[model samples]
Target: MSTHRIRFLAALAGLLLLGAGGNAAAQSTITCESRNGQYQSCSANTSGGVTLSRQLSSQGCWQGDTWGYDRNRVWVTRGCRAEFRVGGASSSNNTGAKVAGALVLGAIVAAAVANNKHNDHDDRYDNDYDNGYGGGYGNGREIRCESTSGRYTTCGYVDRHQHVEIRRQLSNQQCVYGRNWGVDGRQLWVDDGCRAVFVVY
Candidate 1:
């Protein structure tokens, strides 16, 4: 074969390998549903980052992101039907449907690996949640606690309507409320008083 022809063939092979790798790195997604076709709250796991989309605007949906999982909750204040897409990848070059499709792909790969190691634990968990077992991590709430003198501050995940109490006295300071609730539904502040309790829904 001619030198130029051989060089062309080698370049083509490299390009093919690169394209295959790119496809394998693409994201995956999964659709999540509530139990009994009705649920006050629910959650699901994912391989990568997660973003939520509602089937209908009437069905209000809320989500929280954590390591290796995405927690989703729905309220009846609007509607009852919704779904979640998991394993989304963050990319600066893509937008809209392309990004979503990649996420779905990633989720599928992750689920397969997890199933092999744990005997389909992921499937069982989803089944239990769908069947009304109330399976999930946090209660879809965030809590932040601070000391009276503003010397100490702590924040963590809390369940819905979960009561959080912090007791710490700096001198003779009483608990002073800074902000009852955060605009994003996940904040608690205390100043002056040594102890405070916050109920997050």
Candidate 2:
């Protein structure tokens, strides 16, 4: 081989060995405690640089009232290292609060059931009829009536210059009047006393 070619090959071999050694050094590994009863592992690969492998193992036995940090995992990179610790006790307190809330909810449900049962037993001897009718009265000159039953009609009386409302019943209908009917011609009028009516027809 020529002397220059031999020299170039030897220099190339030296450069390759240096590159391999640098790669190996870049690929560093570290281990730490996970603190959560589990192992955490990570690996990193880099171009023309070292890769990193990290493992974290822990034996969870730390406690705090409101917040705290316990020995967990520690990870180290080429330029940076970090220690991960638990500092939040809010989760444990929240869990206990949730348990208490559940118990209270259960007690409330039990009380409601007991109250319902007691009412059911007490109402057995009551003579009051349950017509399921909701009713109220109004003192205004206007009166309104509504019914879920389509067979019945509602009516009201009024004097002249006064307003009257009459609701009709369905099916065969009839009307009977015992007094003289007095009413002015209907006209559009708006006032605070205006009555509202809703009809299915």
Candidate 3:
């Protein structure tokens, strides 16, 4: 072969070797899958950063939403199945944050569950309290009655035995009690008018 061709082949072989070494050095494969639509964490050397090298499922593999890496493991959620090229840990170091983050995530989930149970208990207590006090006089409530286009408008519920009065007038139209505005059974009515806030006691 020609001398020029021999030199060219040698350079090409050197370039190929360097590329192979680079891939073998930092790039390796790890698969993380979200099973049954649940979050799954797979062990990996994640430090420099992780990139989704390939998606292995029909579900979309989105970063920060479906798949993400913290310090030492790759986590996947929402049925995202993908193969990741773990650049391994960065040259800086791994500070064992993976375990810490996992613990924190567990705590957050537990707190949320506890809070939901507490709220449910409070809701039940409120219902029981309401049932226990049937037809009792409640605190004074504010009712806003607005007259739109000179038409009568009714605002909130009014107890038949409760007293209601105009607390604040929101319109230029004068709200004359017993004339332009009054209570009808359980509702406050307004006529010929503007809007006004009422305090129903």
Candidate 4:
């Protein structure tokens, strides 16, 4: 009800917005996997499926571990494994187990949301790239082409389903988005839709 209190609330709201924005701007993500079973070896695999052999050292109050991998199974060789002794739960309330379970669930949800957002952004980029050069426009059924300096540029003559092309422009690099590929060859800008997608060499 007071002016001072109102200002304090406003400042708190701004800080919360700033924190969310900072988190959204982070382009990196965290991925974690834990498995306990009959494993012969251990390794950490990236989300892209590449495996890393180096053991990750745990920080904070957590225990450290090493891992190994075998033909069929990946194993955690040295790490903390929580096991419940027989009749122990009846004697103890298992407070530590409950807290650890909550933490693990939180981590899983965070990872899932981050991964979804990253994939959504990538898809949007692909859509924009497709829409920008998909079809022809203007008075001609075909896309308009013009020579700029030495290279040629193409523009759509109509909306939707129109295609454009450029020639003689030097494209030293190629960009790949989702299943879509853009070729910046020495010729002109070529929009091949999702076909002819370039892969990282």
lDDT of 4 by residue, 75-161 (tens): 332231221111101112333444455554455555556656455443543454455533222332222223334342433223222
Q: For residues 1-201, write the lDDT of model 3, one tens digit per residue.
A: 344654555555455444434433367888888888566889887765788988998987767556777778888876789999887443322223334444544555555556564554435434433544212335545666799999978877754445666789998989765446765546678888868988755
- CA displacement after TM-score superposition, residue 21 of candidate 4 (Å): 3.9
Q: Which portions of model 1 miss their true places by more than 4 Å?
A: 1-24, 35-45, 54-57, 64-80, 88-196, 199-201
lDDT value, residue 86 of candidate 4: 13
**Model 1 per-residue lDDT tens digits across residues 1-201:** 344654554555455444444533354444444334332334444444455554433433444211113234222211334454554343434344344545545554555555564563446544544554333433422334545445544444443333344333333555433222111233343433344444343
- Stretches of model 3 off by over 4 angstroms after superposition: 1-24, 89-201
Point to the candidate with the largest lDDT. 3
Which regions of candidate 4 are displaced past 4 Å? 1-25, 37-201
The lDDT per prediction is 0.40, 0.30, 0.66, 0.31
Better of 1 and 3 by TM-score: 3
Deviation of model 4 at 6, angstroms = 4.4
